[model samples]
Target chain A: MATNITYHPSPVTPTVRSSLRRQQGLTIWLTGLSASGKSTIAVALEQALLRKPYNLSAYRLDGDNIRFGLNKDLGFSPKDREENIRRIAEVAKLFADSCTIAITSFISPYRADRDLARQLHHAERPGGEPGVPFVEIWIDVPVEVAEKRDPKGLYKKAREGKIPEFTGISAPYEEPLKPEIHIRSDQTSVEDSVKIIVGYLEEKGYLSAPPEVNEV
Target chain B: MATNITYHPSPVTPTVRSSLRRQQGLTIWLTGLSASGKSTIAVALEQALLRKPYNLSAYRLDGDNIRFGLNKDLGFSPKDREENIRRIAEVAKLFADSCTIAITSFISPYRADRDLARQLHHAERPGGEPGVPFVEIWIDVPVEVAEKRDPKGLYKKAREGKIPEFTGISAPYEEPLKPEIHIRSDQTSVEDSVKIIVGYLEEKGYLSAPPEVNEV
Candidate 1:
């Protein structure tokens, strides 16, 4: 048994944590309309990253977890919606700071909201530590396609005027002008979608352990 | 090189996640007055868990992260304090649900707030999945000792009437009636405090990988 536990007196910055864990932290922010397969692709992507070759610590933040837990007090009002995205972004940054890959899937209709999320990830820390990587993935699908494939009937409710202020129906979705990766869910299989996202992560060196920390 | 990524269609419950990660998720909630050595002990315990013999994934949530990031909008008002604790508890639960050891160090004086944090961790999921484990550790220290050792001079400010509604001065601290682990920080060394907490976790089998998930 190793009895000597080293004391780390300095604050744990992202750099120190990356070196300690032998991995860099990043967030895969998936934005799309309802039924655009954001959650499906997120699930597959999380599984891919957690399994054999990657063996990374990855977790997902989607409606299932966020809507019922952290943001349950929030509603569809514009202010509430912004607060919802804000809290999610903060939590995702926290996960990334902990050296875990955070995957967030949400409609996140407003460009300002998504930009705020991106800015939160890119902001410098108090000790001058670099910000975590934020990868915006646009899961694109026509509103018609999304409504046709409404698995939970959310789009149907939106179209029927039962759910007010719904995106892609009564409201707007400001598309990402420069997303890191864009996938047309209508034209891509779930497996291929995961491949595209994972490939982008690998090519950008986000999937592997950081080179400087590898020797540790 | 491993291209075959398993598809996990079902919703990922705590059981499924524990099985996949070969570890159970848990939260070690540490409550004490400011300068009671809560943060010091938390940092050491986190290092101990992440290093050689334990090799577990652990993360700390404290004022440095929460106060400035997630709960930045909050102030020192009574309502803001309660909201602060609520958000921290929710985020800690999310980390635990992701199979990470969440260590929260806060001067959470109100027993109701701490109880709400415990309740969030103990409530059953929507699908009947068992709640994640919550360990309430009380770092006990005399108010006079804490005041004397105030590293940030917060106690001095409170006593001088510069900081109103300060805990253990203008406000109150409701001690835990039945904390899982209690340490008198005034008497114990930082290393021994960690040992005592970790020993409790080990004895309760919280440190070991779940038997059912060990072979995965």
Candidate 2:
């Protein structure tokens, strides 16, 4: 039921919130395989963003925090993985709308799903600058290398019946054909890797300058 | 092709940025139909939240903004509508995550969708309160009263083919089986509607005291 109850109650505009966040910065999404230094590179990138004169908010939608909370409902099935990416993409768009460096590190193995995420970045914003930088950073590390440093022993468990539909082990991992940046985890030193990513951001005009404090 | 690369990058925690925002406060979300007095009461509610001692951030996610942006790609189809609610739920969750009072208004036509949204509130946040209030307020006005007002002339257009599948007109509007609060828009004045909503908020502990402000 409806009435001619035309009342104008609240006054915080979507444009105001979006502009405030945009005046800060853009989001940097990092996608890769497990144990491929996605988190490490993303952290380095955030520190680099922070050291600059301009204010930059960085958010990471990763396994430990996001999976344990927002994405806790999802299992390891392909359909679940697709839904998982879809939800994260939407969240990343919100962070981007708020004008922050939203760095998301997920083992988003499917190219189509990642591209679908990229398409969403342009759709739902206050219509100014881009909201999130939907960057596809492929941390190209061999399965063997990842196996050697399997901190979570996820691969081993996948080999056993402990985990189902695990990527790069029981399941197939489709590599990114045209990632924005390719970081090989075994060959590059952490310092050089961070530098390469920071350099890319600077080149893309995301960073005002190189970070004042560089991590070793 | 994958290769071995070792990158020693520092970990950047989101705690600082999250803390800075949390130092601000929490948000309250109000959802219902068009001409349901949602905006009318929401404005008064903002005044109430602002008057309190807590750091307040409030925003109303209404029809115009959503249609123009986030849910633009989605149609009025059942699947699209579900996705529409899902996307909004995710955004509302984020707003709650940032500790802002996010009052969203829509002619949400389904109980399943409403229940799904209620489920999001139970989702736990790190070092913060759960993002959703299990409370749902139904603004119960008869269809005849709603058609009479036709504030936006929407009901008329819906009757025509101009706006296809309009809720409560061509399509369906499922009534809430058990809402936390119910306000009859026809019987109550705008001011009384505000009082009733604010009263419920106070009863639910969303407000500190009786709201000193009222909308006429």
Candidate 3:
């Protein structure tokens, strides 16, 4: 009986590489409305982390790159939304395990789904593999402000019925009850936002003093 | 009918936080078998990238985290395998959108499943986000060697029927038809494997030249 099955080996031993990087690995999940400055703040935060001795990899899953590929077949349904966030959370965990800064931004409006992500992050690795830490950051942008500043005219389209199940307008955006950090984009400038983020990271020990960069 | 939805303003201005971070964004995908050294390599790669001037994030999804969560109900059935990879790929795209290195590890044996990941990487935002580069690297180790080094003892249990579906041994292991790189643990050493991978990154322009670091 020729069963159509295939197998592959698993990998172990990232400890040495992680030590070389000199930073603990974790996932920074940014959740908020479309124009709540989630992506903007995430981007700024990445730059702030760069000047330090840490290695940070930031991934933002906005409308631009996701609509076509992994989610091409997914429509704007509540179920799809959960699935979408669920998938992203899983990937974020993977990044965390590799000892890199895995950052993600999504509406992720449901408490259960966001909690689900947290749960996955804390899980132990199979066969004694270490677990990756999951950090949930809520980019707290008021719905009204987000609608007013729809960067891509998404709010307008949602109201006009051009896009069904739009988040914040047609759809729902659940405010995170509790998060590692809450960034109110409306109140702060992008630079200040970066400063605040960097400040937190510094306190968290993710940052080190400015290095003498003359040596390459 | 108040349907608990979050709304935001439209026509938001593009901020520097978003623009600046875009320049430093990239994806680092780590693909390999179970215990063949994919996660180990991914962690090392993340550490290496962290020392550079770019913002890099690493994501590693293997047996422990994923199997216990979103994929908890699912088994190692073929359909489940496809679904598992599909979900992870979708999440990776989201991370990529955020402009971070999204490194994932799985025994994505079949080419079809791997191709699905590539397709997911190519999915774009509404206007079509630039295709997220899909780098597939096969971390190669002979099945027997992998079983011998079964860090999780999965292969052992699988052969004994304790596990219904497993990769290698009782299951099939389809060699990647077109892997971007092949890291053979059997013949090559770990340092050599890392060298090969880092070399690929340098070749791809992901890694910059070394810099001298002076600690205070």
RMSD of each: 6.4, 9.5, 7.9
Instruction: Locate the minimum summed-lDDT window of 10 residues in model 1 chain A.
Output: A1-10
Query: What is the lDDT ranking, best to worst?
Result: 1, 3, 2
Task: Give residue A170's error in model 2 in angstroms.
Answer: 3.5
Q: Is candidate 1 or candidate 3 better by lDDT?
A: 1
Supply candidate 2's per-residue lDDT for B181.
70
The candidate with the higher TM-score, 1 or 3, is 1
lDDT, candidates in the order shown? 0.85, 0.62, 0.63
Mind giving the per-residue lDDT tens digits that candidate 3 earns over B30-125?
556677877677656655554455434444444545555546546678887887778777666655554455667777777887887887676553
Evaluated at residue B164, the lDDT of candidate 2 is 74
lDDT of 1 at A175: 96
The Cα error of candidate 2 at residue B204, in Å, is 13
Q: Model 3, A193: alpha-carbon shift in Å? A: 2.2
- Models 1 onward score TM values of 0.93, 0.63, 0.63
Tell me candidate 3's fraction of native contacts, as a decimal between 0 and 1: 0.18
Q: Best candidate, lDDT-wise?
A: 1
Tens-digit per-residue lDDT, A46-102, candidate 2: 665544444454556666545654566577678878877877776676665544557
Give model 1's TM-score for chain A to 2 decimal places. 0.92
Best model number under DockQ: 1
